[model samples]
Target: MKSPTQIINRELKAKKKCQGNPTKKYFKELIDYYINIKTLNEFCFAFLKIKITAKIAIFYFF
Candidate 1:
């Protein structure tokens, strides 16, 4: 038979292990999503800048 202290220690260890894993996975997914969105925003801004510059150059030269 297990002593009361041993049972409490086992329960505590189980709870600690459970608590550690889910938050790490959740934050990793959130970071990945943020990075993807940031990269997409940057790409869109660069494309617009290039397009506007080309239009202005064409208008001025022709």
Candidate 2:
């Protein structure tokens, strides 16, 4: 198995390579790697609910 040090070194090398602006493809790849369809949908729904609730609260107070 790879040692912890080896894994860290590999990640550090990748970090250095990412110092420049990332391309659109790389950005999308990173997003896809980190988030799945379900999670993205949950985030969007939660955001919309918050905005709608805030608008209602403002309307009631005004």
Candidate 3:
């Protein structure tokens, strides 16, 4: 079975490959969004916190 670290590494690599922007631009934009954010309400609404939590739970189980 793949380790948790292996799964996380795979996910990161996939994200890096699929993400459209250059790495530098992506990080800059992410940093700006985090620094300027007042609340995670919008973020949570977009992502749906419960769904992500369930995903994490499933990952742990696997």
lDDT per prediction?
0.48, 0.48, 0.48
Q: How many backbone clashes are present in model 2?
A: 0
Residues 1-62 of candidate 1 have per-residue lDDT tens digits of: 33446534743554465565534443344334334443565546435644564576468656
Q: What TM-scores do the predictions have?
A: 0.37, 0.37, 0.35
Give candidate 3's whole-model lDDT. Answer: 0.48
Poorest lDDT segment (10 consecutive residues) of candidate 1: 26-35
What TM-score does structure 2 among the candidates reach? 0.37
TM-score of 1: 0.37
Model 3 spans > 4 angstroms off: 21-50, 53-62
Which ranking of candidates, highest TM-score first? Answer: 2, 1, 3
List, residue by residue over 1-62, the lDDT tens digit for candidate 3.
Answer: 33446534744664475478534443454344434545566445324533564466468656
Model 2 C-alpha lDDT per residue in residues 1-62, reported as the tens digit of each score = 33446534743554466656334333343344334434665556545644564576468656
